[model samples]
Target: MSDNEWPRQLPAPDHGEWHDPPQARGRVLLAAGLVITVLLVAGGVAWQLMSNGSSQPVTQPSAAPVASATQPSVTPCPDPELTVAVAPEMEPVISQAAATLKPAGQRCSAIQVRAEEPGVTVDAEDQPDVWVPSSSAWLRIAADRKHVYQTSGATLGWSPIVLASPAALTAQYAKDGKTAWAGLIQAVTEDRVPVITMPDPLITTTGLLSVHGVHAATALTTKDPGIAQLRALTLRSRLTEAAADPSALIAQMSRQTDAVTASFQVGVFPVVEQQVTIYQKGGYRIPLIASVPVDGQIEADYPFAVRKGVKAGLAEQLRDAISKSAVTAAGFRTQPTAGGARLPDSAAEMLAPVKQWAQFQSLAFQVLLLIDNSGSMNEKIGAGTATKASLLRESGASAAELFNEQTTIGMWYFGAGSVSDPAHTEVVSIGPIAADVGGKSRREALAEKIGAYGPQASAGTPLYQSVLDGIAVMRPKVQAGRPAVVVVLTDGTDGGTRFAMSHQDFLKRLGAAQDPARPVPVIAVGYGPDANMNALQDMAKATGGQAIAARNPADLASAMAKAFLAARSAT
Candidate 1:
């Protein structure tokens, strides 16, 4: 339900002061200082990753990234050593416990503590023996993408994802009542709250929470018109240091604009509950108020999960050491221990589509679809097999059958031609898939065009020239945050004599024209057994994309979809 659907907003929870009790304050200051120091260092490193590596492709870990991992990246010390990957805020508590875990007669059992971002641990080649993320969403997303140990880690403590905005901004939109995602989105749509920011989804679990909550409270499903409104709002952001903590964004927002003025509505940030606590304790350059949705709740339930093959008794020993409930800190809220529970795979799969929706809101996907009209595409399989072109026609035609009205599509079919005169033809110009007035839907038109598509006028395969043509068309569509890609469906390599540029010139052109900041991943897909995988792979890697091979023509649809999502969102 929306904000207006409910009469009143729930009272904001009253939080405690940000300091330790008088009795313990004096004794633990040094330890608290070290932990806080580690947090600061971690923040700096994250900022660097954002500024420097934002353009790099997302590389999967080489190891069995998912199944049968031994332990996280650390070896056992001669003495008993347990390496624990803890969220930055929980480092001190876990580290303290590590100091005391000695085998009955042993001198010490070292807990090598590493302060990692929410989703980083899952990527460790040697999976961290224990995975503790701020929110279960991280663990869940990691599992959906790969086969992780798939266990629900223990919840050590809780941190809700809150909206940190100036009192004036909340009053403008949410005053006289409570604000929920519905209200927040309404305000944004009409331009009441113009400046809103979120951290990078890859680096902060809070980012995922904000994404999920916004998705849940508003659309609940990507199919809702509400998603379009969210997409419009996402396109208006101006904050930087997207991979860093709330501190970096808060500091930056302060300098950009403070409380509401004639020109500014206070910036609304989706931040961790602890960051709000830190600000309320009074070190922030700006003052802020925290708000959680009345109907929708989002929290980081720091889960301590164990990997497979952990010695029979080690998982329990680690779980006990991390989430004893007796162990609490000022910034964190102590919660009851949640034993070994796992998010069901079926549920994770159901929720996974919303993530792609969220990514699309901030990341625009501009893709050019290239279909081969070569004679080979017309070849039928053994006796009963349909031609590759026939399969493409069937899949492309089914788009109109789905409830989803996707972004505009540009469809082209290529064959033989030179640099001066390209061998390709545009079946559908690059434009919105739906027309403003009466016209057969682009989806329907596309399906018809491809279904009837036959071999090119000649039997030549102008694969090289067509690739260059595709790059030219997709390059201009690249934008920051929104990724662009060129997807090609082909049955064979270049056999035509229309190749204009030397293989070197084509390489040099793509290399020099490529923009790391707004990379256009050209995903080359080889359909059927005769297609050249090596040629396709080289083109894909050169443009920061991938080449996928499928032995059967019928599987091209699924393969193309996979390549589309990965190429556009991988970086």
Candidate 2:
């Protein structure tokens, strides 16, 4: 959706009666003032309404579920089937409710939902019959004379966006009780904090909402500094619009060595839940908490509007079913609650509270570091380590530490050779491993194995064949939903498979082998000058993973850590 496509409906201009603070003062003063105003407004409204003995009139249902005559007519039914497009974040709870509705013969299907930035036009022109936007602002933008339906409730609202940090890093702020939105902005703008956010405003509704929340808070406080600082930070943040799915965004955030910060709405529960599961398996501790701004809150309303000329009966029934189910089963409140409910089975449970960092040190991640020891790895580069073996030995050790495993580590190194020649190519399995500097544990163990090779480098890289063999070795140990990442450190291209299949062919087969419900993410680390960066990137991109480049020993550790992070963070 583009800004141009958005319907024009700007908020009324600010009146001079509102204060305008200098941009240098940041958000604190503004936020505090806004908080006071909100409290006053809320209290005054309650008192006035109670005394007047008159209540605010509830707005009539905006529009009825009537079909337009010009559009295709749907058959009228006592109960018409309805489809609701939902963002992936809301999939679990929404789907759960949908599943339960099956006994009623209500056709409830959860379509893949895309969240457009407020004021962006979604291509719902010919897609789902109903569009359930992730936020209230987006709903207002998406609706027109052509598409109008009743809003069930605000799905979730924005909390004061905070920089999610490790407990150690944020302990001071917690102690100072400075975890408010204003505090966060001050910390980030002053370079006192390290935070992360998605890069693109157009793609991530959460990011846009976060910005809007800050803007709204600033507007209430008459503070311009907070807005300016936020704008500056947005420019420097490593956010990118490249992530195509929640899984990709999760993967990218999980891999970061720095503190992770993101703008998330209520719909992100599924992905958050998955993160919690992984952290628990790995024995890492982190708390995920939602922070509400002291000032007026920013809420997201998920609207389900029937397209024009849809069956009125069906639309109405479907809307009723969705409204009833969402309120009862989904973690949504018809109106704001004093505090949000913690999902007992949510990924957010693994998250530490705002400005807190919990150590993720206990569990060890088991990684199968598959190095391409084929002949092409020996190609000389302009400068730097030319051999793939040297690169693997140098890089693999540091990569292992990023996951900080508790037990067994496995390793396999292979080159072009028939299975008959065990000496030429071999698969070596190391400890339920301990972390070592370079060649002791699984990562180092494999590095050592490659070091011992007598340089009988094969003619080609059996990349796909190696991965297949590695997967077989790894498949047994991987727990359901715990990530099983295969970091393929390779040079050149995949060749020398017993079967004449391309890398894509191998990937297709691998994908087929996994349960469609759960798929393993594969990360590719391309090393040395001749490494096929493009091919590796393509492989990683295809699997919703990352393709990183490690040109030298210095870059290898970070790259390896990043690769592991990307792979593990994937939902």
Candidate 3:
């Protein structure tokens, strides 16, 4: 029944904390910090394969008989039939539990089950009195929904997210006896594997956790929360057969062949252990083995959310039965023991990475690389023989590779001899990388210019005017969806008799030109100790962008990642 159909006085279901029993609480705590060491039994033997690199396929465990259920004849029923919405994957488990809850006279049905994805039900207009979503992550994401429901402490089922691959690939990845999450991310980033299919995280739990892993690994390795690696991975993966959802990927895996495996065309997938269990039950032409990342494991802990006005005793009884059926009937774990890697415990923690993943996949970029070719750029970098000018070419080329054809790019350089009208000489006009320019692709033109960049010993920095000029060039051409950005790289402060745009006047004019409707952010990077970071930071603030001070020239590549990401939020 809808909220209005039920009486208002029914004690509002627990809308606050997820109340867990002692054992469940322990499992949650175990899940919080450590890797999953929980033993999952299949065919009467415990699958202690998480820690050890076991290539054995997971066998299907024996399950309780699921009774075929029919519509309840509510003619003589005294209490209203309860409606329970469950995740499509968990529908059978819930249906099995509901089958045994017939009225005493067998003349009425006590409950009805609706199979739906949690993502759909969270915002559905008509909510069932009870909800069993696949993961608590959904609950956290929709925390502000108008219909408040109390989450049960008792998780209906547990399934650790696993990296699924053909036996040969699994063996290769876990050659050292175990593979880590960081290692899996590295493999994806480095393209060690033939194909690693990832679903869109905004829709699939598997995709969400996979992104979490990717971001965690990126942060662990780089010590910065940057999507540079993610940008490259997505661009490369687009070349493969992209799966619309996890089911499509799983279906593709079932057709894998030994020859295909040997040829290395088979792709790897991130999936839940329960799926691995279910897939093994049907058997595949080429079997897939589960590799739980040694460093950590993130699982879908399906929680039962009881909406207010749900029949009091009825919800509890059904929860118990469903919890019991989760293990055997649905191929899920009833008990979670401590041992796998830890994951973000709250929704707030997961949103940052998830948001980054969304933006990387959805947004295209239009950026101008405004580089400084002043004399200071000719100085040696950190006592190294390589001058800053040479390093700029390397760093610029590296960062440019992260952008795809859809991204638009351009370049300009400013210095003393930059007597051009704008105090910066344009090498490439802003355009999509795929667009043709002077018989060569824009990408090719940008690369050729970026590589040939060098410092002019007589040149002095004309940074202030260049900032205004870059914005002027970009403002009128700002595309509807693509984020427009100005990336300023300078080794020295504004100097020399250039256009007389004072710092205060430049900020005021820049601020006035900013249309809330069309934002063009400036990501300003200052290199070396002599660079004027304070002025660059002020410019960034005025333009709704970010500023980075790179003490070492090598750090500019990392700064570029942060630059693109900061510009991603531009209006």
Candidate 4:
């Protein structure tokens, strides 16, 4: 019905009441009453509408909206509280990220960040809801220990492992181009840059990765140069603890004018790239430079691991809130491809070097150096100008430099007389190298003895008898924590005149002398091609020692280093 048109007044109810019987008359009266009521109501509405139109047009009010229980509200749910455990180096960046998550503004989570070492976190009984470790290796370590966590499957930031050194020492090398691990190894080995400190592999992931890098670079070689390098460092006390702060080293390097002295005083260390960035900002006298290994960069890919029970929404929110800009601004590369080298996927493969380093550290040295002064020693080695005896003297002095004050060493040269008649002459009895002997250090006296020794041109080799007599004499002197070793350097087969035991008899006796509780390994060096290597090998195997075949001066020197390392670390 149109609003403007008033309802046509109902046809005037027949106002004339019918003149009929009493019942009919009563119904007619009721009908008339209903008509009169309708007319009165319509007339009243018309009167009100006319009065409102005359004054002003009427406006109707909208119906009130129903309060809904299921509709979404304008305000958001309360922000959740999240606990984050991060690596020590990542603490600052992660803390900055946490502050950006304001509960009152963007409705982000309330993050509680704590700086923790990944090694400690791996074994922790109670873990945080979120964990950001410096390297993904820690995740493998955690999994190996059955510490369950769900990785975000993305790295938050990246920093490659680098060889950190003073810019002054490495200026020429760095200017040449990016240095490889081989170059670093060669430099350290040649004493171009003397001291090289490595963090203890057992204590820090940086140390673990550094050793792994060295191992990977030398994987194809028969014996890693790292072993020899490590042995040298151990003897020289150059391998320092994981006290990585380089302030003292920088100060010492800055003052030294001589390159050799500076090399000895200052050492290069392996650390993450971010540490170099932080160190450079310190404004030290000697600025440190980081050389990324070109063969493969062992990087610290900061993994964002989420615990099982943490809400997925909260975890994702946190991951997104930590922006790429923030990460880069904090000196972290946002991409996983930042490193050139890829680490081993398996946890055990990555941990192999760490185990080897631990073995190297467990050595306590007590060694006997038995040299052959037989006629064969005067023969030239492999067309070289140096004779076997001359090379032996040189290598012996170098090896002697490897022993610290704690090592007990003795020297003996044998080739004359019979086995029962004291054929071998002792140059120095087994004693501490630092001990005073004849008003001079035993080390000095020993050096002098090795330098002056000459070959006995008429003497027989007597190889079997010398080993037997050395073992018999040294076995009783074995101390509890020290490994007692008899290192025999021979160049020919035994020329026995029915006085020395046969090779087979020697092997049997060596095996019979074995004491599982107290082992004394016989590390024998078979020098030159004609040496009795088979005999030496058999005897060495019988006593859990090694037989090294040395063809020339270089081979003898290298092999001797390995033999000494094996002897020191035996058992």
Best by TM-score: 3
lDDT of 1 by residue, 1-571 (tens): 1121111122222333545474664344334334433443342224224334435579986865564477566554563345667776566566655545655675445445677776677566645666677876666666765636545444677877777776545554465556576666545433445455666666667765665666456444234232333332232222322344665554444443223331132356777676567455544433567766653466777777665555536556656665454334436677632321223255365355434534533334456788887777778866886777776666554322221223456788877534454578887777655443236666566656766777654455677778877887777776665456788888887766556455566677778777776667788889899997887888888988889997777676556555555555554
Q: How do the residues 248-351 of candidate 3 rate in per-residue lDDT, one tens digit apiece? A: 45555565444233214445677777777766665554556776766556677778898876666888888777547445555788877466445677667766
How should the candidates be ordered by lDDT, best one leading? 4, 3, 1, 2
In model 2, the worst 10-residue window by lDDT is 352-361
- Tell how far residue 213 is off in model 1, in angstroms: 1.0
In candidate 2, what are the lDDT values of residues 430-469, reduced to their tens digit? 4554445354445445545655643345655667666666
**How high a TM-score does candidate 2 get?**
0.35
Q: What's the distance in Å from true for residue 166, model 4?
A: 3.2
What local lDDT score does residue 183 receive in model 3, on the 0 to 100 scale? 70
The local distance difference test score of model 2 is 0.44
Cα RMSD, each candidate: 16.0, 20.1, 14.8, 34.5
Model 2, position 331: C-alpha lDDT score:
39
The C-alpha stretches of model 1 lying farther than 4 A from their native spots are 1-80, 102-109, 140-154, 220-244, 250-266, 283-285, 312-318, 321-328, 335-351, 354-571
For model 4, name the residue pairs that clash: 297-341
Cα lDDT of all candidates, in order? Answer: 0.59, 0.44, 0.66, 0.66
Evaluate model 4: give its TM-score.
Answer: 0.57
